[model samples]
Target: MSHPLVIAYHLVWTVYGSWLPNDPRGSGSRTVRFDPLADLGDIHLGRKRVQPPRREVREFYDHAADLLKHPVLDLDKAARAIVGAALGEVVAAERYTCYACAVMPDHVHLLVRKHRHTAEEMVTTLAAASRAGLVEAGCRDPAHPTWTAGVGWRGFLEHPEDVRRTIGYIERNPLSLRLPVQRWPFVVPYDDWPLHAGHSPNSPYVKRLRAAGRYP
Candidate 1:
């Protein structure tokens, strides 16, 4: 997709060693860069939610977890808040427009509107800020790498439907993982985008914000 066509981006990345190339859920990777993980099949899978592999197979992937350089990141509430606050600062400083954001246990998802910056640049900046927050709070080691190695998923959204759908998906991610509904202060509501007028002001997130007394 061209830069101009993109109204927003679905930026996703895993914490270090959390999602291997051969995860039970589908992955964007084609190769298992780690030698121990290579023995497991590297099925070239799309990112869509599919019938997850068998439970045993899912548990089997952990056998190779020892090979990873750093522990998988399972962010608690405090860690999530730290990252969220740091992300809010980046959004404000860079003049980024965030339509949705979810800080998951093992990864993060953000839907940011088109800005003077590129999607990759936003991802990099946001990740750096999160790392700094963790380090400053003494949650992560100063030298520890926070995110997974290699390419993170970047799906560009050109249409309002795409933006709406992604917003829903990001919001439901935590619930699907059996985690509480995450409410981040950094996420702004997606009220009919000026460039594309069909976006709904009454998104699930909007309702959530209203329920929590967090919206205006």
Candidate 2:
């Protein structure tokens, strides 16, 4: 028998305009302007390569890690509302069934079913609309970039077991890490998390999984 057609997608929603500075080696420049952290002074008397300043190095690494870890949205109540509304629109347009969703200060995690959209396409739509939504929600600050360039993680699930594992990982990921924690903000709490809208929560796909006794 031919294998069934099933696909799963796990996407991460990063904070708006909160990307960390990276090494510029690939940007045509041979070196970074001034990495205080990496620039350790040498032993002047001996002109020897002494141990670099640990504190500076540590600070720089810590700072960069924090920045790249997650985004922190500094939106007021009204702005959040707008962002939420806009996100709803994007989700609807994409036709993804969100199993679990968490909105963190700096990022988001969405356990959604793969629709007619690709991971890249979903991210593009979300990033664009979310930014516009922020502005619509009254964040008119020209300095704010609205969103980072792309998503952090986009996992494609090909098996029933993988889907179960991915969902568990996404839900507990926040507790497993530090701040910019994502909170369950918009998962369809009552529909058993179907893949498509209007499909019976117990669609044929799900039945087949159960029949196979592999519905993780």
Candidate 3:
């Protein structure tokens, strides 16, 4: 059987399709270019601008990540509830071992166990559910886009040491080797962890990658 994996995927999208060049604000008018670090050869997977994005676009992206706070308790209850509930369901249905989750206004952070599904499936389900939930809650307006275009990252778990690293990043302070397992593992990388890769838990590659700070 294929070994299970620990994966963490972000809602890679930005509001108003801000990351793509096809949108009005995303057009060259903003002098935006793609991110050099993530770009592949000549193909720009994302957009950048010489000038900052228009206020509206900036506000939209900013708001998407900010509304993560409890909207109902605050002002945007419907939006917050959608994310909160959607994350809960995603965790429950997938039976993922969740590490740490933070629902940012525009996006969410889910460190979940990697199991039967692929990273693509996990992200897709989360996005769909969150969108549906928002609509049901009367927060998602048809006039505005529900999601950007894609998710942020679906980093595959690379090794035990790396898993520890990510857990820390997600702020999971495991108790004395302890804590009731949150769900599955909390954070699973794409699927390259030593254990997930069918290698000995202390495989040398894990060590090397850790030393190089590229394990994840």
Candidate 4:
């Protein structure tokens, strides 16, 4: 069957060392770049599957940690806030519309409305801004990487229900990570779709056009 047109994207990415090539939760990597990592554990290239126990998975990454070149990133409360602020700037500067955003300890979830930029571009830009924020705030070392080695994952969202589901999912990511729900200044509530309001009502783009707040 054909897929519906994508109205938005649900993007997710991990912090450095947070997820490995061989993870119980799974990864998107096709090949293990680090030879040492090849035999350390089995690689689960797909997003997720029905295999491996948490105990074994932890042991794998724990041993794998010693073979890494940089420290693992586990963002603290302050660091998450800093990253959120950096992202807020990007929303204004890039003129992007964010339906949901949550900064977790090891990863981030974003529900971004379909825009002039592609989903890949959205992840890249947001990740860059986050890295800059962490470095400038001394939350991260400039020599180390903020995100994973790859481009991360992005799935298209087409329907209004799909968009709403993704919005809820991103917002709840922090809680799943055992962190509190994140409230980023950049995130706007997903109200209605473009066909109804001439644009998504709560989106940054329309918020800009409403009244005197043109272009924020």
Backbone clashes under 3 angstroms, per model = 0, 5, 42, 0
1-216 in candidate 1: lDDT tens per residue?
Answer: 112245688999878877778775667888777677776665557754665667755575577566677677688889988988999999989988888889987899999998888888888888999989999999999888988865488998755667899999999998987988877776888874643355355765445445655444
Which regions of candidate 4 are displaced past 4 Å? 195-216
Ranking of all candidate structures by their TM-score, best first: 4, 1, 2, 3
Candidate 1: residue 8 Cα off by (Å): 0.6
lDDT of each: 0.78, 0.56, 0.51, 0.78
Give the Å error, residue 178, model 3: 28
Task: Name model 1 segments beyond 4 Å from true.
Answer: 1-4, 48-50, 195-216
Model 2: lDDT of residue 38:
31
Q: lDDT by residue for model 2 over 64-174, one digit each (tens)?
A: 544342333555545555666666787776666776665555566666676887887877777678788776656745456666554556777655456677667766765
Tell me how far the alpha carbon of residue 175 in candidate 1 is from the true structure, in angstroms, after superposition. 2.1
TM-score of each: 0.81, 0.56, 0.51, 0.85
Order of the predicted models by lDDT, top scorer first: 4, 1, 2, 3
Candidate 2 Cα misplacement greater than 4 A, ranges: 1-6, 16-58, 61-82, 140-143, 173-186, 189-216
lDDT over C-alpha atoms for residue 150 of model 1? 55
Off by over 4 Å in 3: 1-78, 171-216
- Tell me the tens digit of each residue's lDDT in model 4 across 151-215: 78888876667788778877777777577777777788776565354555566434434433332
Q: Tell me how far the alpha carbon of residue 68 in candidate 3 is from the true structure, in angstroms, after superposition.
A: 23
What does candidate 1 score on TM? Answer: 0.81
